[model samples]
Target: MPPPRQSIAHLAERQFGVVTTGQLLTLGVEPSWIKRQVRHGPWNRLHRGVLVVHSGPVEWRTHAQAALLHAGRGAVLSHRAAGYQHGFLDSPPRVVDVSVPHARHVAGSPGVVLHRRRHLGAEGWAHLVNRLPTTCRPDTVLDLLTLARSDDDVISLLCAAVRARTLPAEIRDAVMRSPRMAHRRLVLEILEDVEGGAESALERRYRRDVERRHRLPRAQRQVQHRLGDGRRVRADAVYDGLGVRVELDGEVAHPGGRTDQDTWRDNAVLLERGDVTLRYRWRHVRVTPCSTAAQVVAALRSRGWRGTPRPCSADCPVT
Candidate 1:
């Protein structure tokens, strides 16, 4: 009989390196066969005893895959890693994070980030379609909220999560049940603050903490309000009560193709309204929504509107 086919060729069909000894045993390949294959350069050792066949470049599986291999039987992928796996983050994270039982610290490998917590309650873990483990939406959000430093960071993340719809209503409700009820409330407030009000990123940020928080008179967003020159200009937001027209100047909005004409048209609108327009960029709108809102509120007050500066804080009463 032909010398048993080279062990290296046999395992390559699966397309991932990093296999356990038990897997080899199940392949009906004897222990002596494995040793002989290793000694004869038919396989390459990746981790301690974790073997890779020698026919191709060493393949790097996802960190989740590596973690599952390391944790062996009990661990599940979770936290930021699971978020990435579940399409929570707008972009993939640079690191691999995994969650294993508190029973013991699993051995580490290069680029494998392990998080050990006793809180892997049943809801925290889920199988990723028979692949590496992952965390459900609620647990992932909870993990992020627990670790993030500022309310702003949490809000930013929450906006993206809600937009992605990875955070279902049930997951959001579960967050309220956690010990951080106050923070959870704040997150929900932030989520409500941003949803469906504005179309662009900059406009959403402004509408959430600035327009709504300050109780500035409402504006017709993306509406075509015409100027005397018969030029029709669609302002980002137009508050007729304050005669204050707010425009979120973004590259995408005024992409240089027709922005100059649009700006000239906007100037026409301002002149018709007797110079009562306030234009803002992303930086001013995002960093200091309160201050930006204050400016807009003051301008609105000038136009015979009455209001006080309303704190955007969750505890603040309606002004």
Candidate 2:
């Protein structure tokens, strides 16, 4: 006889329509009935002993459920999978990443990446999303940082998480507490930059390439200024001594009319106050950073800055 549909449905509902064969057996379901359901009924097998309770399309949630079930007990969604669950990732993960105890040996599959961890049992690191166990937002950030391929990738993810308010205070605590994490020094430096008002990848790039790399003096970031009409504007980076302000346009696409007008108005006010502003785009900072730094150096020089620009690398265009 088939297992009671009502009981199975209740369990599947909580698990995104997925269930392990072990769960069914524990619920008094016969082993033969479980195989029969997959053989002839609406049930679809996702992994070894893991089945989707319905015949519908396998969505992201179903994949997550299957991965967790296949990893056995104490496995939680992690890395890019957890980033998606925390609403930081733009799309559903292509590969579901699940974390298991360091001592547990789980067979890996094409669609699932299993991570073995010795410290995953700590409190406040795991939470539930869609009834699936996942790393908390802070932990997810740290985990994703490890998987980042480049410094740009790390900055992009960190800025996006911070902008979306998904990154929590505990992220810093986690980073500082974990002495074994790879890229710990770089991660700490990026966190400090973000906390110090480098809120976008573009802004961070400008700081790294245009200012620091070129040996330009440190400028106050996100400096607030008030217009004659009481409108407040924040400059991306401001050199108070040189009266030179730098604006970073990070958007790849052109701005709308209103944004353009606001920029024009803000520029007019700043110009009236004798403050010189220079604007740089995303490509300017990332692609031809040396040339971009030269321009900034020129602007500062025009404003009576006596410091000379220095080359960051041997091939650096800036002299």
Candidate 3:
């Protein structure tokens, strides 16, 4: 067998250069030796019982490992931390979120958020990422929605996941089946809208604030059309009977240059077919929905829509 020092080094390498005092003791290293190494050697203390083998610049994974070690047994990375680990988040987690069994009494630390779960060890609740235990992607998304501060944040996260094709169908089903989850009703409603083809937060806002709120006729979302050159194109929203199309120009949907050209080409094709297309940007849809509704109403009326536009509320300007 290799020496105890070699064994410890190998273990630390596997764990993002983090090792616990208990792990060192289990490797047959003397307590005095471990203390001396931490005090005088390259090892740096991260938590009460956890030490990083390197004193140099630490990576994001090192922070995760240290938080997991400090959280003790039966704990898994969760929430934003799990989102980051699973590539759902654009940036590294600011604070580590760890879920421990309800029976365990792990206290909260400076850089760690502790969540107690009654059935954390149940099958399918947790999985491994880079050798570290973490909540499943679906659970992480739900947890994030619960922890979200505003409806816009929740919608943004859901839209990001959907745009990246990382939001699985099972996650939506799970949320629907879970009746006791916090914000369950709101999440289910959003999931229903998403399933109905609101692929981005901007599209969802248009559907809600501009269409439903103003009492405008419902338009088909993501309607595909065949161009003169036989190229297939999907319009953001289409009113078939009225021959009117509403396009939400979200940044993710119409990334500049090539996509812009494609959008212009699609608009020309629709216009040639006697369709009226109204294109709106993020600011137009989100910041000024009343004005957007007015424009859509005018387009729909010109295309023979007889339904009168009504204000969403007494204060709404759509009327």
Which candidate has the highest TM-score of all? 3
Give Cα-based local distance difference scores for all models: 0.65, 0.84, 0.83
TM-score per model over all chains: 0.63, 0.80, 0.83
The superposed Cα distance between candidate 2 and the true structure at residue 110, in angstroms, equals 3.3
Q: How many residue pairs in model 2 have overlapping backbones?
A: 0
List clashing residue pairs in candidate 1. Answer: none
Q: Write the per-residue lDDT of candidate 2 for residues 103-185, one digit (tens) a residue.
A: 99999776999999998868887988878899888888889988888888888888878876865356678888788886778
Clash count per candidate = 0, 0, 0
Per the 3 Å backbone cut-off, how many clashing residue pairs does candidate 3 have? 0
TM-score preference between candidates 1 and 3, better one: 3
- Pairs that collide, model 2: none
Best model number under lDDT: 2
TM-score of 2: 0.80
RMSD values, in order shown: 7.0, 3.7, 3.3
Per-residue C-alpha lDDT of model 3 across residues 154-235, encoded as one tens digit per residue = 7877766665565648677768767787777777678777878878788888988898889999999999878777877678
